[model samples]
Each structure stands twice: as structure tokens, then as C-alpha cells.
Target: MLRYLSIIFCAATSFSIAAQGVVTLDSCRAMALGNNKEIKTAELKIKQAGYQRKEAAAAYLPSVDFEGAYTYNQKNLSLVDKDQLLPVKTFNPLTQNYEYELLVNPSTGQPVIVNGTPVPLQMALLPKDALTFNTHNVFAGAITVTQPIYMGGKIKAMNEITHFAQDLAISMHDSKVEDVIYNVDAAYWQVVSLKAKQRLAEGYVSLVESLDNDVKALVEQGVATRTTLLSVDVKLNEAQIALTKVNDGLVLSRMLLAQVCGMPINDQFTLADEDKETLAETTLRPATFNMDNVYAKRHDIHSLELAVKIFDQKAKVARSEMLPTIAAVGAYHAMNPNTYNGFANKFGFAFSVGAMVKIPIWHWGGLSNKYKAAVTEARMKQVELDDVREKVQLQVNQASFKYQEAYKTYDMTCKNLRVAEENLRMAQVAFKEGVSTSDEVLKAQTAWLAANSEKIDAEINVRLCDVYLSKVMGELKIY
Candidate 1:
């Protein structure tokens, strides 16, 4: 049992040493960016857009394709049917046309006829086999190259659209980065705030415990009643309970911050600001901003502008379908049984080059309607962008005002905390001298806790306000 206990103790101690680290804000932001699903998806979208742009650009170049086929025929092709015979003819000088040489009978002075046809003196015979042609096996193939000469500017517009699409994807990625930074900053500050409160709670509990001991001493000396001791005991119990609650809250807040950093929810980690008494505290200064510059730098606005450009290009593509299209085509063809050379029993090759043109006469208003719809969609996107720009302007102004107000509140809380600290000190001194009631001491302690808590909140609020104002002004960046 001792050996087993030793092993467990060593493992826990090693884990503690390994888990110790001061995680900075920049580190958390980097981890979140690396682990975020949205950021990875946005990266893939940018790559996809890049490939699509390349595809569009390829339309400007010629495309080559090949097709081939083979077939079998049952019989050969023939131009003539069966054997044939021809009569021999002789040319006569006195006559203009050729005269057939007719066979004359010995007893008849004229010609001999068989079945009402004259008999020629000589005839030549052609066999059926000589008229047959071999065409049983056939093969054909062609390789064609087509290049677009003109398409009413559709190709150019498509390429432009893809380029803008890539830009849009990049802008969206920037927007997601800003969102991630905002979330990390919020969770990080929450943990810091909770840590400060936890420390405050511990201090208050200790102070109350010391007072309880002093009151017990008073009771034993016969200078204070049991009623006074009971009251002090009750306040001590309340302070202990409050400390317990703050510790539990701090644990949960740490869990939230860990989750936001893309770490395991149950993992143990420390924040850089957790040990510090102040949170996100820095010198405050008045600031001025340029709305035009903010609008220009905003990722959403840039994405919307890209959307408008893409829609306009789509309108052009729709209109291109209504205009004339032209292409240059060249091809090489090869066929068996060589028909180009008297249907010989061999393969023959041929090359051809030509241009094609298409003119759209009518489409029953279909193409026209599509183009009009695209134009309307582009216009709508433009109007939405304008509206969002105005809203962003208002949002920046509001956030700026809130940011300044947070600093002012912080100043007031600081002064109040000082006053509460002084009052608590004075009350404790008077109570020790037996000149003040225990009730006054309790009130002073309570006031001190409230003031300290408010100051912590004010400091955190200032940090939050700064984050939001930077977000609205498009100043939050990944770096």
C-alpha cells in the first residue's frame, strides 16, 4: 500500500509541474485560431475559390478531345449486279455517230434478230466477282481542337467573377478571425476577474476569522455578552460561505476560459493575469477615429463589395447568352476502308480546319428576363451594403462612448475603494478600543467588499469596452 501511494503521489506532483504555465493573451488567440473549426473551413473556402478561378481562366485556352469507334458489316459494297455484256461499235467517217457492228445472216441481206433485238458482231463479258468491294470491317477516329474566338465577353466576366470570389473568401476569413479574438478576450478577462474576486473573498474570510477570535477573547474577559459573540459568529459563517462560493465560481470560470482556448474543459491551466491584483488596467486616453477608414478596412464591408462585383459579372454572363458566339475548330480524322481513295482496303487520314458562328435570333424573353433578374439582385446587394455602412457608423460611435464611460466609472470605483478601505481600518481600531459597536464593524467590512468588487468589475469592463470598440472600428487583427 505504501508503494502504491508513493507512485500515485509522484504522478500527481509531476502533473502539477507539467500543467504550470502563465498563458498570455496572444498565446490563447493563436491556439484558438489554430483549433477553430470556422477558421479551418474558411481556409478551405479560399483554396476552393483559387481552384475555381484557375478553371475560369482555362476557358481562354483551346481544348482538345478525342473520339473513336469501330463497327462490323456482314457484306461488301457493290456498284453493279451480276455479269454484263456489251456490243462492239465501229466509227464511220461519213456518219457522225458510232455504228454497232451487227452479225449478218448468209441467206438474209439485212440483220438477224432474236426476240426483237439485234445481234452484235462481238460481245465482252464481266464476271460478278469483279464488281464486289470489301467493306466488312470499319474503323473511325477523330481528334478535335476548339478555341473560343468570341462569346460576347462572357469568358472575361467569368474570370473577373472568380477573382472577386477569392477576395470575398479572404475577407470572410478575416471576419472570422476577428470573432475568435473577441471570444478569447471575453473569456480570458472573465477568468481574471473571477480570480481577483476569489482572492478578495479569501482575504475577507481571514479578516472575519481574526475578528471572531478577538470577540471570543472579549466574551471570556466578561466585557462582551454571548449575544455579541453570536453576531460575530454569524458574520464569520457568512464570510466563509461567500469565500466558498467564490472559489467554486472561479473554478467554473477557469473551465470556461479553457474551453475557449480549445483546451480540454477539465484541463488545469493558469492565466497570466490571475495572480495580478488589477485586470487589463492601463493608462486611459481620449481617442479620435475616421469613419471612412473604418468602413474601408472592415471585412464584412469588403465581402459585400465583392458580392456586388460578382453579381454584376453574373448579369454579364446572362446577357452573353443572348449575343453571338464564335469559335475556331480544327480536327484530324482517320477511317478504315479508305473511302476517300476509291474505297481501298486500308486506313486513310484527313485534316480539316473551320470556324463556327452562332447568332441568337430570339429566346421568347427568357434570356432577357434572366439578365434583368441578375441586375436587380446586384442592385439589392448594393443597397444592403449601404445600409450596413450606416449601421456600422452608428455602432462605432456607441462603442466609443461606452469605452470612455467605462474609464470614468473605473475612476469613481477607485476613489470609492480607497474611502471604504479607510472606513474599515478606522472601524476595526475603534472596535478594538471598545468605542464602536460590532454592527458598525460589520457594515464597514461589507462596504469594503462591495467597493473592491465594483472596482474589479470596472477594470474588467474597461478591457471589454476596448475590445468591442476595436471590433466595431475594424481594428482587431490576427497578429
Candidate 2:
């Protein structure tokens, strides 16, 4: 008993929520747009493109870099001894006296004499070693700044490409929004169509039931045969079955609509009732379309055009790679154990400024091939753009033709409905006056039901066609 009571309460709550208000087409569109993941992704892409543009622009600014390093050598650097000569005083035994001697010139290999006496000269070469790097720890640091003076227009091309990417992202976002709106409209109208059919099914069942009751009464009064009552019963049963199916279909259709609107699948809601006569009257009227403006407004066409521009910019960038680059460089360097001047354990600072040029001398034709590839890609993009334009024109023409056809069908069904209604009324009058059989009445009722169903289908088709036309023309307002 508790479980049953809980289920009943939940169902009542659902019904109360459903009865709060009707979900209009605009409301559904808003909900879908707010919750759709595709739209959110597109929005993120736009932000990403914005950052890319900034990154490309940053290439024009100066860049600063800092570097530091420390090292320990196994041994200090040393200079070996240099060859040299020195004069010496010596005693000559042949002279029997102490005398000063001159040193011999090493390169000339000749003895030197003083006062016409040949004196033996003695010389000695001294050996000395000097320590070049005595310190075990070395530290060096430098800060450098570089500014690009010329880059063969690569930066400009890249900036333009980023701009094109941003435009493409925005166009894609608009296209996604249009798609969401189209889906919502389709789901909303499907529910509306099913609801109309459900109502028609209910009315049909009621009609058959009333006829069955009248036939049973006449049979009991001996005014109608049992077979006539049995035939009415069969019609009533079939009509009830059809009503059941229609009701089930209407529930499912509503669920589908709710899902499309970003609502819970099981969430129940009513649709704002649209008057069929008003819809038919409004849609039956023909209006002229400006195809030229429609083509211009299409987001896909704009996106393709942007893609072509982006490709062209890429080609420019590729061509720029083959040209020379120029930049200005400035640096300040400081190091401990200053070894540049000598082996001194003191920190010293130095600064310098200069310009650099990098000319592409040889690359085995690689740069030329890359530029050619970029050009070919740009050409392909242009061809694709042309193809898209042609396709857009074809879509517009197809949608226009479909709309016209749907309107004609709706008009014909409306006339047929009127005829069917009149035929049913006449059949009922004849049956009451004993001129028509039960079978004739049943046939008339079936014809009326068929006509009603056809009219409903026709009306929905017209509405769908209108939506298609608007979407193809890029005039559907998603916001």
C-alpha cells in the first residue's frame, strides 16, 4: 500500500509540474542554445583564436633572455717555459786570467770577441711556468635582448591568418546556433502535429462509440438488425485501438521534444496550442524571396571565404621563409673569475650592441617547394569556395520548390477535409431517415478520419518546409 501511495504522489507531482505552463517555441530555442555543448565548444574556439592572434602579434615585440652557468675544472691552465739566452762571466785558462765572456747569439750561432781576443761565451736558457686559471669555481651570466627589424613580412601574414581564424570561429558558432534552432523547431512541430492527431483520434473514437450505442438501441427495439450493431461494434473497437496508439505516440513525441529542449527525457510539459486554421491561413499565403541577399547572409559561405584568405596568408608566410631576416641584438654580460682579460677572481661586467642579418644561401630548393605547396593549397581553397557557393544556390532552389509543393498539398487537403465533413454529415442524415446502411455510415466516418489525418500531415509538412526554406536562406533567427 505504501509503494502504491508513493507512485501516486510522484505521478501527481509530475502532472502538477506539467500543468504549470506551456513551453513555447521561443522558450525551447532559448533553453537549447543555453545548454547545447556544440555552442559552448564553438565559443571556446573563438577565445582560442583570440589568443592565437595575440601570440602572432607578440612576434613584433622585443625578446629578453637570461643565462647562467658554473663549472669546475680538474686542473688549472699553465704556460710552459719560453726559450731565452743570458750573458755569463767565465775564466779562460788559455789566457791565464779571469775575463768576462759574451754570450753567443742562438739564431746566428756565432761567438763574440772583445779587444780582438776570441772569448768563449757561455749562455743558459731559463724555464718558467705561469698559472692561467688558478680558480676551481667559475660562474658566468648574461642578459640579452633581440628585436626583429625585418622578417620578410612573415609576421604580418601570420597576423592576418589569425584574424581569419577568428572570423571563421565566429562563423562556425553562428552555423551551430542555426543548427540548434532548426532542431528545436523540428522537435516542437513534431509534438504539435502528434497532439493534433491525438485529438482527432479521440474525436473519431467518440463518434464511433455514439453510433455503436445508437445501433444497439435500435437492435433491441427490433428496428435494426444484429449484424448492423455488430458492424458498429467492430468500428468502435478499431477506433478505440487507433486512439490508444495515437495517445501513446503523442506521449513519446512530447518526450522527444523535451529532450531536444535540454529538459529531462521524462519531464512532462504542454505545448502552447497553435490554432490549425490560423497556421494554415498564414502559411498558405505566398511571399517573394530575395535570393541574392540570402546567399550573402549564409555563414558557410563566409567561412569558406575566410578560409581562402587564411590560405593566401599562409602562402605569403611560406614565401617569406625564403627571404633574408634582420634583427638588432643587445647584451650585458657579467662573470666571476674574469678570465677574458686575465686570471683574476673578480666579477666584471660588459655590454655590447650589434645588428644581425641571416641570408638564406642554400637549401637544395626546399624553400621553393614549400612556397609552391602553399600556393597549391590556396588554390584548392578557392576551388572549394566556388563549390560551396554553387551548392548553396542548389539548396536554396530545392527548399523553395519544396515549400511551394507543401503549400499546394495543404490547400488540397483543406478542400478535401471540407468535402469529407459534408459527406459524413449527409451519411448520418440518410442513415437516420433509413436511406443509408450502417456500412455506408461506417465508410463515411472512415473517410472523414482519413481526411483529418491527411490535413494534419499536410499542415505539418508546410510548416517544416517553411523552416527549411528559412534555414537554407540563412534568415532563421536563432537568438
Candidate 3:
């Protein structure tokens, strides 16, 4: 029953304390990486590029397509408006030829002629109705297969471009991950820095409270004046106000950190470093200044390189448009009202195999101009890549220099903090021995607070510097 009560009490007080859970830098980085919208977008782009690459690869193989069409006509097809013909022919084996039979006049036993016309004795009738065709529903369908014989290098270049695009997408994702990690680190450390300052401010308030008491007691005994007491009171109030400000800043900083970690802004959590008196010394890694290595490690640089290659392949694709293209085609055709069989109302099937060649003869130099533009675009990308390389190199150098200088600043602040602590201790002892005034002791305490605050700032600065340096070098690790 007691344990259950304790659990309930703790749960109730957790949010009030604004310290419910503990999270480390590594956990924060992982959370941000998993939840960041920009990172997710980049990952989606990579997937899209992968599908595009597959599509380009499919171009290397044959494709089959099917089409079917139907039509209905209101009227039957007519071959002739009126037709009447009668003629007779018999084979004459004696002459090895056919001759027309003529109508004979029985009275004269000779061929009959009217108006210089020979009359046929026998004839075959061809009626107009026989020439009419049935035309109601017509159906046509075809199944075609096409394989690229030679596309003047367009297919190959396009395939290569897709590969480059996929690589570029991956590189862009890596770059985004680096940026996310850097931002999360900055926010996390800022909260930790402010937490430390809050503690320092509270300590300062306590020291001033003690001084005020001492001065008040002295005034009652006539050793200190009322003016001195008022001064101590003012200092105590200032220190308390400073502590309040620090607390407010800490709350906001924690909120920002939580947002970066993809958590609710109002969520309560404690950082691993928040309770520590000092941040651990950062392990300084040696930086390699070799640009080749830097270029290899930096995702943005790699992305740019890939962009250049993609453009080069695009230029090749454009040039291919001006070249001759060849393709192999095969089809199976089926149609009703088969002309292959004397216009019978039955479906007829036919298969054909052929090849198509397209030669770009003249388009007013359009294809040539397009190819030239593509080449120019490729060259422009190369120039941009070079320009970015110079800027990134400078950025790397600046970040490295600042990272080193931050350590030096931290060391100096560390020394000043120790000195300040000792100075305050000596001043307190001197005042208790009645050799120094309370004002001197108050001055020492204020110096100590400033020193501690500076140290905290310096420590946080060093951490941020490391994060920035790693990012600029494109070596920002996951943890």
C-alpha cells in the first residue's frame, strides 16, 4: 500500500517538476532522425528514384501492347447503285482460246447483229443486290510487341542517368540527416547550459541572502550601517530575479529541445547532462585537410558530383535525338469482315514482323540546337560544382579553426571558475573574522557566479562547435 501511494505521488509530481524521463544525446539524435519531416521526405525521394531506375532498366527489354476498336455503321455498304451484265464464253480447244457465244438468226443461220452489236446467246447475270455488303458492327484488334534495336545510345544514357539520380537521392538524404543531428545537438546542449546557469543563479541568491543576514545582524550591533543592509537587500533581490530568468529560459530551451526530438513541446523530460556540474571534455579528433577525402565524405559534394554526371548523360540523351533510331516490331491483327477471304463476315487473323527506322533528316536545326543546349547545361553544372567546392572548403577550414578555439576558451573559463571559487571562500572567511566588509564578500560571490556562468557558456560552445565542425566536414556521425 505504501509503494502504491509513492508511485501515485511521483506520477502526480513528475510533470510539475518538468523532469519525467531521462534522455541522452544519442537517444535524442535517433528520435530526431526517425521523426524529422525533411529526413522522411528525402527517404521518399530515394524510393521514388529507385522505382524510376527500374523503369529505365525496363526500357532495355521488349514491351507488348494490345488495342481493340469497334465501330457501328447505320447503312449497309453499296458497291454500285445499279448493276446488269450478261455475257457467255466457251473454251475453244481448237484455237486454245475462249470465244463469246453470239445469238444466231435461225432464218439466216448466221450471227444476229443490231446497231453493229454482237448479241450473246448465253449470259450470266450479276445483280446490284449481290454487290451490296453487310455493314453494321465492325471489330478490329491488334497485339503488338516492340523491341528497341538501336536507339542511338538514348536508352543506355537514360539508364545511366537513373542510376546517378538514385545515388544523388541517397546523398541528399544523408545531408539532411547531418543537418537534423546538428540542430538537435544544438538545442539539447542549450537546455543543459541553461540548467547549469539556473543552479549557479540559485547559489548566488543563497550567498547574497546569507550576506544580507550578516549585514542586518551587524547593523543591530552597530558594526554595520542601515545603508549597507539596504545594499545587501538590493543585491539579494537582483540575484533572485536572475534565478527566475534562468528558470524561464530553461523551460523554453527544454521545450525547443523536445520539439526537435519530435516530442510534444509541453512534454517533461530531463537531459543526461543537466544534473552534471560540468560537461565532459570532448574527444578531439584529428581533421584531415585533404580535399579528396573531404569530397568523398561530404554528402553534398557527392550529390553535386552525381548531378554533373546526370547532366552529362542527359546531354548524351539529347544528342541521341539527332541520330537515327531503329526498332523491331511484331503484331498479331484480327478483324471482322475479313478481306483476306472475299469479304466474309468472319474474324480473320494475320501476323506481321517488320522493323522501323527513323532518320532525323531536317527539323530546321532544332535537334542540333537542343543537343548544344544540353551540352551547355552540363558545362554549367560543372562550373557550379567547382564553385561550391571552393565555398565548402572554406567552410570546413573555418569550422575547424573555431572548434579548436572553443576548447581554448573552455580551458580559460575553467581556470577562472576555480579562481573565483577560491576568492569567494577567502572573502567569506575574512568577513567572518571581521577583517573584511560584507560588501567585499558580496563582490566575491558575484564574481564567482559570473565565472561559473561563463564556464557553462564555454562548455556549451565547445559542444556546438564540434557538432558544426562535423557537419561542415560531412562527417556528422549518428550519435
Candidates in order have lDDT scores of 0.86, 0.82, 0.87
Write down the TM-score for model 3. 0.91
Per-prediction TM-score to the true structure, in the order listed: 0.85, 0.84, 0.91
lDDT by residue (336-377, candidate 1, tens digit) is 889798778888999999999999998899989999999999
How many angstroms is residue 253 displaced in model 1 relative to the true structure, after the best TM-score fit? Answer: 2.5
- The Cα error of candidate 1 at residue 162, in Å, is 1.0
What range of 10 consecutive residues in model 2 has the weakest lDDT sum? 1-10
**Which candidate number maximizes lDDT?**
3
Identify the superior model by TM-score, candidate 1 or candidate 3. Answer: 3
Show the colliding residue pairs in model 3. Answer: none
lDDT of 3 by residue, 1-479 (tens): 24224434543443334343877777777667656788779878989999999999999999999999999999878777888776978998999899998989999988999899988888887888898877687889999999999999999999999999999998888788788889989999999999989888988988999889888899999999999999899999999889999999999998898898777999888888899986788997565578777888999889989999999999999999999999999999998878677667999999999999999999998999999999999999999999999999999988888888898899999999999999999999999999999889989998998899889999999999998988887778842
Clashing pairs in 1: none
TM-score of 1: 0.85
Q: Which ranges of candidate 1 are over 4 A from the true structure?
A: 1-20, 71-137, 283-288, 342-345
